[model samples]
Target: MATADPRLRSRAQQQQPAPVAPPPPPPPPAETTPAMGLDGSGDAPESSGTSSDDSFKLKFCTVCASNQNRSMEAHLQLATAQLPTISFGTGSLVRLPGPTINQPNVYNFNSTTYEAIHKELADQNTQLYTQNGLLNMIGRNLNIKKYPERFQDWMPGKPRLDHKGDQGYHGTESGVVDVIFTCEERCFDAVLEDLHNKGGRMNRPVHVLNVDIKDNHEEARVGGQAILDLALSLNNAASEERKARGETGWDRGSGGARQGFDEKVPEIVAAWQERWPTLPALWSLAWF
Candidate 1:
């Protein structure tokens, strides 16, 4: 073979060095890596205080036929049960948007009974106005003055029902409510239909409990007691459930804890029936 030029030989030798691949491009900025700049297993997952299942709030709407005796009684009873996280209100016009009927006699009935109850409570020094903590009591324990400011003007015996078709009941915008209690089948049907059609705060699921009041005394005494009993028992179950689950909120000790209506309502209903036999004929539990 012919001898190669020294310069050419040197060039060939330099070129002969094996090809070397550039280092693999730095791994794409690991998007999965947490912002803390630590690799996997380095950081904790985001922690929101509330449980994922507990995202929704619980609300109760006590709707009744007249909103006078039966429904009003139920509302008062439910209010007193004082479940920690629930909100309560009573009236034919509260959630309704349109005008409501007026009972000229309502002022007479609601005022007289309310004042009598208020005066009695005042003597006991448990007057609602005097004691902020006792405002939610109803029926035998009701404090008219301590009634919520929104309900301050409500007359107990007064006809809460506006006979004129001008009135309507509507739930608020706070959020979806879990339950609705109505006294009597007619009332339950009407209220449910209204909620189904004209929806808002009540846009969520609801449960209806009807009360039967065939007679005036039963309407007044048994009706009130049954409603109250239902509320108290239901709330109590919720409290127990919450306690078991380690939930923290208001009125935990006093049976005021929010509960899943579906989970606790059946037991509550059974408990209520056991407490008051008359309650069975009037009540129907439904969910929507």
Candidate 2:
């Protein structure tokens, strides 16, 4: 037989070993799936990054136009839900007041039966003026009668430290920010401008949660529940894995005021603040 060419034989043997196909590209990174946090809700995660201001730990901030119905409900829900990798707050440092309660001849602060409400908002500098027209407007815009049980249970009767453990807007970003959120389109734009001017989060991701404002108290309550559920889902997504593995440092105190809801709320809020860093203007709505 003719002597086979060594180079050609070697090449043929190598090729014959088996046409091993190149490993397929890694599924294109799974498309990032909308940043849904812990709660299983589709709510996007806030940005995470080092802030220009090293002193503060807010590499991100959530911007909302007014700390009233929609935004305040989101704040409370996020606080209670314990979202991970993110913090929550209104755009400006001003505190927000809860909705107005029914009263008679409430001209000044003391004259009003809802003085605690006043103080609650006062602490945060949230001034909400509820006229008779606003009530009608709330009735038209929201369905308060939907979730009465939840309203009675979670709604803060009187806004107190509701700060979820003495926490307030530090007014600076000095932490890792995963994203920023806004409650309303307007607020989102304003925050965008601020970020653009300050080069916010060194060009991080941002989300907008556009929601309608409610004049009716009960409708706002329903909306609050929706927000709470969404917040819980998002929060759960980030921390559930860690919590399931017996992780601590997220306000797991044994007893005291934090025995139940009190302790859990602040812990969740703090955790969220640390992770999300920034929020846009919009309501946290959950689908399915």
Candidate 3:
């Protein structure tokens, strides 16, 4: 009520916080929807496609040198896990290295039965394989599945004929797999080379991965478990991506084929590698 001093009044006015500027009008409600004129619609554009569970169903192939040891072990493991898979040998010819370097046992993958090989090995010198555990390995292989096969025979080009002039097995010809897991470094190189030479000829893309594993029973078992874990992780990631993209079941190539291996596969691979860091193992992925 009393007249305040001019300096005091000026100081009071200066201390009143300068009106706070009203927070810049709440940023215009963030646009809600993108510009409609560019795409010709204000409504969110409907997804061009959708994915189904079946679309996410992946086919797998496993490869090793002879297809009787490492690859077969992985094949049985994948089957036990209920994932569709096939196994193949990357050797120029299907044969097993015997006790001594000179005593090699050769067989045709498509026609030879594990039973026959086991019998032959057991008869040659029961003490040979029996001492080194080859006999038991062959025995276990016999009960797992059908006869072993070769990877060259699975190529998309002309049929690989045996000396008897018979067409090679066409198990893989029925459909191309989404992924191939090779058990050793040599097999891995063989698969990638084959794919590079023939993949462009095929209509679909394939992802080939290598998990360097020793060619022994124990190593195969360890490798098989690793492969199964990686596979399940991949399948789940694919399904989740499809769902996120609004895909449904068996959508038949809707949702646009996945972009390469997607971001999750590398992370999963790294974790898997870390799990077995000391095993002289390597994991690599290639597209074809």
Number of backbone-clashing residue pairs for each candidate, in the order shown: 14, 64, 4
Model 1: weakest 10-residue lDDT segment is 6-15
Which candidate ranks first by TM-score, i.e. highest? 3
Q: Which candidate ranks first by lDDT, i.e. highest? A: 3
Model 2 TM-score is 0.34
Report the CA-based lDDT of candidate 2 relative to the real structure. 0.30
Each candidate: what lDDT? 0.36, 0.30, 0.57
TM-score of each: 0.42, 0.34, 0.67
Q: In model 1, state the lDDT of residue 107.
A: 23
Q: List residue ranges in candidate 2 displaced over 4 A.
A: 1-63, 84-181, 201-203, 239-288
Which of the two, 2 or 3, has more lDDT? Answer: 3
Q: Per-residue CA lDDT of candidate 1, range 1-288, in tens?
A: 111222122211100223233222112122222111111122422221211223322345554432334444444334333321222233333221111234122222233333343344344343322333211222222221212212223222233233221111122233234555655555544544444334223122345566665523335444655665555555455546666664554222222343443456666676667767765533333222
- lDDT string for model 3 (1-288, tens) is 111222222211100212222211111111223112111233422222222324455667888988877777666555444455667897867778675699688888778877778777776667666656666666556555446777767754343333221111223334456668888667766766655555455444455677878776567766766777767667666666766665542223224335533445667667767876754444444333
Model 3 quality (TM-score): 0.67
1-288, model 2: which lDDT tens digit per residue? 112222122211100123233221111112223212113244432332212222212112233443334543444333323332222322333222234234321122112212333333233222232222232222211221111011101111123222232112232122323234445455544433333333332322332233333424454444445444434434344343444433343222222321232224335444544443342113221110
Q: Best to worst by TM-score, what's the order?
A: 3, 1, 2
Candidate 3 ranges beyond 4 A from true positions = 1-56, 156-173, 246-254, 279-288
